[model samples]
Target: MTLHAIRDCIHAKKVWDLCVPKRWRKHFFLTQDVKEWVRKNITIKGRLEDFEWRQWFPIICHNIWLAHNDRVFQGSLPSHQDTLVQSRACLAWSSLVLHVSNTVAMPCWEPPDEGKVKFNVDGSLDVTQNLRGCSGLARNHESMVLCGFLYRMPSGSILSTEIWSILWALKVAWDRGFRNLEIEGDCVVAVNVVIEGVGEEHPDLCVVQEAQMMLKQDWRVNLLV
Candidate 1:
């Protein structure tokens, strides 16, 4: 039933006829084995108009299956044109996502400004094992390690762990007499809470307030995710 909807249905045939080239149709339609048919369609690379056949092929099959369901269950018949248009839309969206993923640059670590120390902190949790820990390190402008610490927690929520890590890192830096400092943590919630103070009723208000106090003290400290 599934195979019939994707490959042998009327709408599926129409899409294949419009996309598959004349020279390829013989081998393409002759593959009766499901695995072999799918393998050939994806690996035998070619293009249909402006779309790559590998990407467009599965999209067309998916849309065809959707139309089949709509017609069968909802009693709404879909034209071949609608299925083709939907397939094209899916292909365009997938292409845009792929392009963005390939072209966009990933975030990289940057050293602190001259005369300032950078503290990078991160927390980890293993829910199944009920384990949590956090580690932080401070580096000077020239990238030399100034101070660092690793502490394990008996039990705590993720947010509390992140907040505690920030608090600990700040305390460590201040104790080492680094007044000009920049703090970086992968946890956005913790950094944002410290920058933009939380309300009184917030769940993690205690730790957040403690972290806020450390930031508000007489020193220059910048925080970011």
Candidate 2:
């Protein structure tokens, strides 16, 4: 059988394999008894199998195998039935990579001639379990352009969301090629995290730091509460 066929077999068995803990996967794969059980109980090929299932099998199987071997408890393992879970993870990973790329990417706006300044603004959503709302904005001093307010639904008070908004603003500024930017935000916590270089205190601040480094090339960041 081709590698694709083997992958299809692995995908077909993923639901059962997911129930088996990470520590047990290697043992399950290597154990002769388990293999016999799989062969007897799990059919690899048949007209009943759909083509989409075959296509998805390799991706799911590869992730499961990596999950088992890596054995890092970073977060709760998603359910096997969550076929799109890996796709979500891939999107998040891609966002992170794109974030990094955009940080170093060329300045979207040129630095204003001497004496001219560019401003970038952002807002935050501060909501508790019971309260929900968002606050932030961006503006450029050179262009005198002000960005509108950012809104959030219920359960938004978490610090991570604010930091994420700041990063988003930076990306916008970078895209506009605005050099000499003054970044403004309403979140004191987010501003202090960037100003004081307290990344360890707020693990999420790493994203802000990366954006700051990128902005340093042609822009200056100003934190406003």
Candidate 3:
């Protein structure tokens, strides 16, 4: 349901809070109560293109359902750490999907110079789940597939997946007896990281560093774009 429609559901019986016993709150457990519950109507105002609500509401609901299921089936309530991990995973997936859908597309894959393979990597976050997949394909100048691979990763930001795609593609090319290669991706931020061999201080720094280190390995003058 749209967030506006959920106002009644959030306020009437506080279905979200039904499971949290008063004793739990007496201990001052932090709660996710529809993000600012009040007696007045929620405006739900934002920029037309902004997707904050769509991205965040699902995380809250997913965590709540997960906690419920764990308590019911496993006879165990999720810890704060568990809730944070699940919620972050969901948030990462949402961010990835929004970035991919909004990414501008190239007309079609272009062939690189002869003797050099064009490695194109694309990443898409699974919209309905906390998973991300990246596809990397190496094609010769004749549009022949030298090698290709897809890697499924746990929930993370799109930049991390993009960086991983590059790393995996490089390994695939080296294994397939290709040396000269041109790596390409739609994410300018990720591409720049490969070219500069560095990334800003962020959670994705580890993967970015790995990809850069892989680039230093003997690969016969690979180009990043």
The predictions' CA RMSDs to the true structure, in order, are: 21.4, 16.1, 14.8
In the range 22-112, model 2's lDDT, one tens digit per residue, is 5545644553454453453243332212123233334444555544333335544434544334432333323334565777763344333
Per-model clash counts, in order, read 0, 12, 0
Candidate 1 structure quality by residue, lDDT tens digits, 1-225: 456778777777887787779999988878788888888889877888667788888877777777777788999756676567556645553454466579886465699989999987777677987888776767788875545665678877887678878988888788778999898887898888777878888777887787788888899998877
Error of 2 at 59 (Å): 45
TM-score per prediction, in order, is: 0.51, 0.36, 0.50
Best by lDDT: 1
Cα lDDT of model 3 overall?
Answer: 0.59
**Candidate 1, residue 82: lDDT:** 52
Q: In candidate 2, which residue ranges exceed 4 Å CA deviation? A: 1-137, 140-157, 199-201
Query: What TM-score number comes out for model 3?
Result: 0.50
Model 2's number of clashes is 12
